[model samples]
Target: MVKAGRVLALLLLLLSFGVTAPTATADAAPVLSSVWTGTWETAPSGTAPALPGAAIRNVVHTSVGGTAVRIRLSNRFGTVPLTLGAVTVALRRAGGGPAAVAGSMRVATFSGAESVNLPPGWDVLTDPVSLAVPAAADLLVTVFTPADSGPATYHRTALQTSYVAAQGEQRAADEDGTAYSAKIHYWYYVTGVDVRGTAAGSVVAFGDSLTDGNGSTTDANHRWPDRLAERLQGRRLGVLNAGLAGNRLLRDGVGPSALARLDADALSRAGVRALIVLEGINDIKGSPEASDPVAFVEAYREIVTRAHALGIRVVGATLTPYGGYSAFTAAREAVRQKVNALIRTGGVFDAVVDLDAVVRDPASPERIRPDYDPGDHLHFNDAGMRVLADAVEPAVVG
Candidate 1:
């Protein structure tokens, strides 16, 4: 028989690893909605240095307006305790960078405290700060680390530049951009932002690099989902982009597979009422078993069934042509055709978005339109991204 001492030690070990019992926040009043969510992924350690006694400013755009806002910070990939010294939120100056609009900044607290400690594999939601967050405008979330925090947790390939302070400088409360001279493309330690408002709900764009805006202009917010948010400005809906570059549907790569992270990335957001799936091209080109429509279809069906259970509507997008890519092959092209055909008529989702019909070249029918191809032949250009966004029906999202 196992000793009582051994049992106690085992329980301690599990608790150290962040295993804890669930608690209820149901009695909490004032419901808020998440207007922007960037799914967190472990940043390759050593690729970017940790912020020791420095401030990092992450610039994110909101999809809807609100009177109060809160930020979510994560240490999911850290190997040590993450200590935060100060946190602030403010409206970004028109041109971007770390600048905040004068007199618009507000201090964010955790559980009524100015600072908080986050254990490894854990995240914290800040107490709501009253700020007039405008729809489709940029917000800067600034964080200061007081000690030599180990390797940072970041989302690689943010596609928009963010600012970090030089060593020996703590600029989390700075209202100007001069204190922040260094810039990086990855967003560190921030996972999401929630707003208190009357928005109907959020729409999550779940997919791979195509949906992540690989070739779109930097700091332009021209990603298809961003354009879709712009199109949905006057409405009571929010568009949250959950795309991870090089993601797959059947197996894990850059991030967890769609099937694995669906619950956390797509369904966990605040007020999510719909999901748009546009993945599987990476699986077609990367995984041997994924070349068949059967496996891809099965995964899609599972995603639909799970979303439907939560009363969330699901929309499947037809995979676009990728003929000129280096890894393209006749077999993979055939698989794409079969999968697109299924998405168009399989009735696996509540509705369908015919992306293939909107962006394919008429002459070849198997290649992206010449003007839409951004030299990669796989991802779309800015104009193409807008076209893809324009094709999404507002009525369907509502």
Candidate 2:
């Protein structure tokens, strides 16, 4: 009996240690990962035509919570090596002005040359330093380049807002020479901005130009995802914009196709909790022969399934109104409506963001409200972009 009692005590001791030991390490909160958000606009450093429409700028009001950040620059569609003369990141005060010099500025550069060679399709350039950011703080990331090739392959679809100025100007410089003094909706090659938090987990926004904020104002970080990030300020969610201009759901085009880019864009990110997918417009518009409603639905399902397998929640965003676009036709409109129906009623997604319902005109369900359309009848202006952000449901993120 004595021996048996000792054995029982030993077994109990082992069980208690096993149960408590593992949890001690497991109980530590996750290390939150940050996402970089910005746009790829045009410039004239070489024989390349000057990109005049909307130059990128630094946005001070839009950034909220973050302790550390990393900025990504792209050489992704350059024929020649792009030269960045100097790059600086600084803090901004309220009303879109520069803040008092409370923190030191950081410099960003590539390894090989003062200029970085960006091959045909993609380039990921990181800052030379990491920044210590604070909650509800605003900072500006500025890049200076001596020249660029013609028609710099800009990221037309930038979900996060950014600011830009001429080659040798500061964010707080006088408006006469600043490229961003006059707001326009164009971006240059800086693709993303990542913020670090004390916790673990992040979210990636994956889609095309609309998700990229094609028609929104430049230097004004007013993209919907930007607003979403602002709303999620204190929550343990990090937002990354993986949107690409002319990106498709299944086919490869401007940036990488959705499926092809998935690993690099979302899965490979440091810590990902959920993926918000707002794609398929380009696929529907570009591929007339490829328009099998069933196939489109299946592809979407596959994307969600793959994400789920990786333990990531998949959030589906209904494609916004595009009935007035030059490419819009009765057939395409039918497809759009059909796909949206599936997304809304389809249980495949873990959650849904009905962008269509939010921006569509009540009188004309097929088109966007004039107030919301950024003149292209497809994209949103700054105000319209704000509505898009408001349309997102916070619960869907979880």
Candidate 3:
């Protein structure tokens, strides 16, 4: 190497002649950008009774592995300021439930503090915690509050089971989880879990109960989105499900309308590369029905336009068959057929995943395949979810 004094003298000579030196780091390691992908998420569908001094153990499955992770808590439906006494994240034991894997727990802080206070209708993300998160694994995010902060923002239809601690208890940091005995299907406070150093972005599965795994086996993680995540094992793309059971595209009930909450649930999510939409069946079947197929098609186009504006590719999924359901009417079927045709041919999305074509019975055309139907006729079984996942071509996704 050249001496330091000689290098300085050379630089000064070059500067005197108005010559600039070349970058010395041309062969150095490339600088990497900060990449944080949303590995798992659930939209807030409604509010539930607050737990007060209790802790909620929200069990969430990851779509991608990472060297570090962060948690998001929500008070979107709260009328009062929500105060969290403590928060912790841990890997779950193999058998599952409240118990955590030994030495895998990490405390979550807000601005380096153990506690955080969230105002009404707002959400907050915890500071990053160094942890090794495995892909396609379970994580237990425990939240404890010492005071009654009014109605809690919650996702009402998590098909997987979560746990709730006894009242007057603050066991957010508990690893054994004996304090959490009461099993609950609701996910409280915790809205999302994000993993870093995995994929640079994620694909959002956006829709209603079909995407939410409404008819699949409980605690099986067999939702279509979950199955899709399994296929993305090393594709460098995370998968996040933004489904709401009974959610509609034109109206609000189980959650805000798909259009109204699009940004909150899917568009604004961390590092979204593509979106898969499987909504509109509810609008066709619900009371005060949206009879106009034009309305539904317009909504799909709007979603595509909005996603495209942010450089995100949109995938449209045709609504599945519901022939044997109680709300199936010939007129509603006609409306569904019209809307689906438009989605398939109207150029509403960058690509299409024809879920209805795969899950519908070839014999009846309007009914779900016998093996895939879980007796409800509208929703899919584990096998059907697998088919849906298989139908999503990796090449087509952004």
Estimate every model's Cα lDDT from 0 to 1.
0.79, 0.60, 0.85
lDDT at residue 170 of model 1 (Cα atoms):
51
Give model 3 RMSD, 1 decimal: 11.6
- Model 1: per-residue lDDT, tens digit, 350-377? 8999999999999998899999999999
lDDT by residue (191-294, candidate 3, tens digit) is 78887774757899999999888888889999989999988876978899999998999889687899888887888777788999999999999988999989
Order the numbered candidates by TM-score, best leading: 3, 1, 2
Query: Residues 1-398, candidate 2, lDDT per residue (tens digit)?
Result: 57988977854653332211111111123343433322111111112243333234544332334555555555544666455455555555445543323554666555523334443444444543566666445566655555544455454433335554433434333232234544433345554455555534566778777766678776565666666777776665656666666778877777667887676566545456778999888877785435667777888898888788778889899988788787888888888888899999988699998989989999998899999887999888888888888877767787
Worst 10 residues of 3 by lDDT: 21-30
Structural similarity to truth (TM-score) of each candidate: 0.89, 0.69, 0.90
Which of candidates 2 and 3 reaches a greater lDDT?
A: 3
Q: How much is 112 displaced in model 1, in angstroms?
A: 0.9
Best-to-worst order by lDDT is 3, 1, 2
Worst 10 residues of 1 by lDDT: 19-28
